[model samples]
Target: MKETELRYVLALLRVQGIGDIFAKKLIQHCGGAEAVFTADAAILHRIDGIGEIAIQRLKAPAVLEKADAELEYIRKHNIKVLYYQDDDYPERLKHCIDGPVLLFTAGKISFPEQKIISIVGTRQVTPYGTEFCKKLIADLAPLNPVIVSGFAYGVDIVAHQAAMEHQLQTIGVLAHGLNQTYPPAHRKYCPKMEENGGFVTEFWSSSNPDKENFVKRNRIVAGMSEATIVIESAGKGGSLITAGMANDYNRDVFAVPGRVTDKYSQGCNNLIKTQKANVLTDAADLVYMLNWDLAAEKCKPVQKQLFVALEEEEEKVYQYLNSKGKEVIDRIALECNLPIYKVASLLLKMELKGVIRPLPGKLFEAV
Candidate 1:
């Protein structure tokens, strides 16, 4: 967070072809950013990826001014800047090939070093996609993993909103700068995120939300998490891109399979078929794949019996109802693959047990 180090990091980013990898090397060679600024061209040229043109640009007055301006902008906005060497830098992302030399963060929430999962999918989500995300998030909530995702609509929005509702710390990697929020309609939810979670981006304050930035943003999402989950997507979308990057980074990639005929499910199904991602049918599938042990040693004796009493079918119905938000008896019967009379009787019993409540029009939801 030193001013001199911040300025040099910004300057390094401006140099052509000198990205996070080379920047770290330069920092190591020169001892620090302050020293990097003072080092001669001959010294800079010896480092890999540093060409004559870039070294000259680094020494130029105009380039220095631009770096200074970036610092001034950060100062004016009260933004938090994280350098690669800083302890606060996300450890999962620090080793990424294209990780940013500096990150501009706009909120107070600290990134957790524990299990982190990125949920991504098509911007145009279907009803099934929505329910899948809500259910997955609800089940994962108890594990306390930090949820990461883009702030785009569809799966990203649902993931973030559900995480917030569950009181889980979530991080949104933005396609643009923190100066503005893309899809301005999301402005309302952002403050809630800043209040409860955080927002992050590698772009400078004035950087526009260009088409290409989204591709760049995907790397941050994939690299910063222990795993990536594709809720729904077509063959092409940012979610797929993130999944590919996650694989490249040797991180676990899980995809939710939908009906084979559904366009949104095709991408996920294909990923699983090709062995590019693990098939995720529910939260337990993800938990098992990630090898997450949900067991706690301090639990009350009665709590274990309470959980054991519920049959698998009851748990499925409970989770489905919680995820669906609301559904008619007929719809639940269809979705759960249960007979109408059987579903109706179970619904009444569950209601009496305070597991769910019924509303008008035969709608029911978990209490």
Candidate 2:
């Protein structure tokens, strides 16, 4: 977009009560950002959402001055500004109703037709979560999926680091502006991350990483990707919110299962129990659900290679689930001639082993 046009767009964004959806509506009715400023009063009144107050806001000189200052900062920093209608903007994101009208990016970024998945979890990541996050990326290394995350602590940073370890491109979606990095410890990773995959945000130079921004940030993480995977979370956390957004976007959502006793696992477990998310044991589960197998099936069609050995009893449960598609726990014990307690124990072990997964209402199915 031309600098003149960008100036108008920025000013429009600064208008109070005019959010992304409304901004897009205004632009559509007014022809373009620049035209919005010059449109006749009669024309402006005809637009559905544009009224006296909005027109008054548009006429404010202060808005243009602020936009000019922000434009200068962006130019100085060499940030790539993506207008919502630009050809280079993320195509998947454009389809989202609440996607930003402008996105500022810094880094060497590319969103090819290859897989792009967001991996999110608790900021206080557990050792188990770390291992699983690392292993999942490692298993997916061959495909070189573009890893996306919040760029915060815990699973977000771990996912980025794992992707870096495998030389895969990784993008960090920040709640703050590109002018600074939050959690200064993460500053060290910013340079290397930008070299491969950089930071992207809708926030401008003046915005700080406040509490509310993180929740708003979750929508971008969820909207841009075809799917989202929750590595671990508490019963209520931002990660679950991101998963919910992904589901609302009609994107695939996956949650790693953890023991019911673990606090962080409760969120993920509840997601599965409620059927809000699919059971994501390993990369293969994601691969199968997303039909990523089409890419690897050419070289290797060993989806079952992801499975591990089950004990004689666990095997009985696994085979039963595999054959039946999904079975309730009591029925599995009755069919396998095992006690309900023993079946429950075997199911937990099997779930941990990634052979079978638990569904809502006590259903179990083979992975």
Candidate 3:
């Protein structure tokens, strides 16, 4: 795109109350960002949502100055400005109505025939969540999928590190601009991250990591990916919001089921229960859902449930475990109306029988 056109697009962005959606609409109706300013009354009248106030704001001198400053920063820092209409822009996001008109990115990024998935969850990720994230990335490494995450902490940083370890391209979609990292502690990873796939945001250098910006950022993470896998979440958080946006976008969504009693697992459990997400145990579930070539990528086959006979008491415990996804022996005993000792003995037998496996934190799940 022309330098002049980008300046106009950036100016459109600086207009108060003119977000990505309205900005894109204005640009579309006017033929280009530059054309929007010079558009006559007839041109503006034909645009559905344009009003007199919007036209006046479009002519504001301060907006152009701010855009020029941002454009200068882009040129000075060698930042790649991805226009929504351009080939370098994310294809998945282009289909989204509220996708950014211009995305400022800094990275060795390319999306040529790639599989992209966004892994998101609470910043206070548990050990179980960390293990599941690392394992998921490791298993998906064979397919060379691009890992996308918020880069905040916990599951995000873990996913990025695991992807880097596997030498797969990973992008940290930022809530702030590329001028600075939000968590400052994550600054060290920036250089290494840009080497593979780096940071991206719609905000200019003038923007900071405000609270609302994070929510807005979630849409990009959810929009660009073929699917969004929530590793873990509480009853409320940004990850669940991302899953909602992905659902709104009609993209496949998956959630790793956690024990019903676990605090961090509540959001995922609810998503699964409400049928917002498919049950995701492994990368195989994703590959199967996305219809990625099974032969081309070597993902471990999903294990089919074993048809095993059980005593009445054992069957009750087994059903409880299966229903909860994962459960501790105590929870099982209490829920199934069995004594703790009896449940422990049954679990031992179940483990020996290769029907269930024990997890860290005394959790057990049907195999």
Candidate 4:
């Protein structure tokens, strides 16, 4: 949390071709980035991956200026910076192979001892996929677990929204800087998240939301979370990257099953069939697998109520609401493949019973 430490760390990270792994090695060998900067070239080269080019880059005035700019930006925004050695640095992420040497954060950060789950999927999620995400988040909320996601469209947006609705802390690992939210459409929700959870990034404020950054961001999300839940993904999607990273991090990976024909579900189904991920039918399976006692206690009683009163259709709707969080009537109908009028009437009845609450814009939250 020291400003000096943050400045030095950002300087080291700015060195060309010196990524998290190399940066960590440099830090460990030299004691810190400050030491690395002042260390002899011969000693710097002795560290793994610290070749002459990287060493030369570290010594460049331009590189120093960039690092100083990053530090200034952090100061301007009052961003909380955590070096890997800091106690507040996420232990789970630290254990990962390529964890960041420095993290830039905004808003409150909660490092829960409970299970952490990363929900990920395609940005263009299907209606069914969105519904599933909402329900899953609602079910997991009472356990007070930390939810992690990329804050992209589709499943990611739904997961964050659901967590917010339930007053649960959620972290969005950005591919860009904390200076701006990607896709601009997410600006409104970003402030909401700042008030409750937080935003985290490895990139400096001036860094662009480049393609490679997202791939790198996936590792942080997977590394920090105890498990990764892929709500709906295509064969080639960023969610797969997070799932792969989770596997690499030796964390449990779960995927919701969808109809075989569902393009969004194909990646999830493929992951299960390939034994890359466990097939999750509902929140219970996830909770059991994680050995989440807190979530189990809250879920068991609700399971009974869910089973006793819910008809097949109502159960499906409820489950959708629970997973996807609050959703519009049109979306629910499209997801459930039911008539809009029928879905609306059912939602009204559920709303009256305190099972869900209707929000503005026809959005409904599971109560």
Choose the strongest candidate by lDDT.
2
Worst 10 residues of 2 by lDDT: 293-302
Please provide TM-scores, in order, for all candidate models, with all chains considered together.
Answer: 0.82, 0.81, 0.80, 0.80
lDDT of each: 0.82, 0.87, 0.86, 0.80
* Model 2 Cα lDDT, one tens digit per residue, 248-308: 9999999999999999999999999999999988775776577553223222222444647
How many clashes show up per model? 0, 0, 0, 10
lDDT of 4 by residue, 1-367 (tens): 5667667788777777888887888788898878999999988767766578877888888877888897788788888887777788888988986898888898888675656789999988888887888877776665677888998888888889988998888899999988888979999887789877989998877888999999989999999989999989888888998899899889999999899988888999999999999988667567546655432333222322343475677778889999999898789999999986567556644543447665665577776
CA lDDT, candidate 1, residue 133: 94
Model 2 lDDT at residue 245: 96
Q: Kindly state the number of residue pairs that clash in model 1.
A: 0
- After superposing candidate 2 on the true structure, give the runs of residues whose Cα lies further than 4 Å from its correct spot: 294-367
**lDDT ranking, high to low:** 2, 3, 1, 4
Model 4 worst lDDT window (10 residues): 295-304
The sequence of per-residue lDDT tens digits that candidate 1 reaches over residues 226-336 is 999999999888899999999999999999998989999989998999999998877756754665544323211112223334566677788899998889877888889
| lDDT tens per residue, model 3, 8-118 | 998888999899998888887789999987888777877888788887888889999998899899999999989999998999999999998988888898866578999
Q: After superposition, how far is residue 314 of candidate 2 from its true place, in Å?
A: 18
RMSD of each candidate?
Answer: 9.5, 6.9, 9.8, 10.3
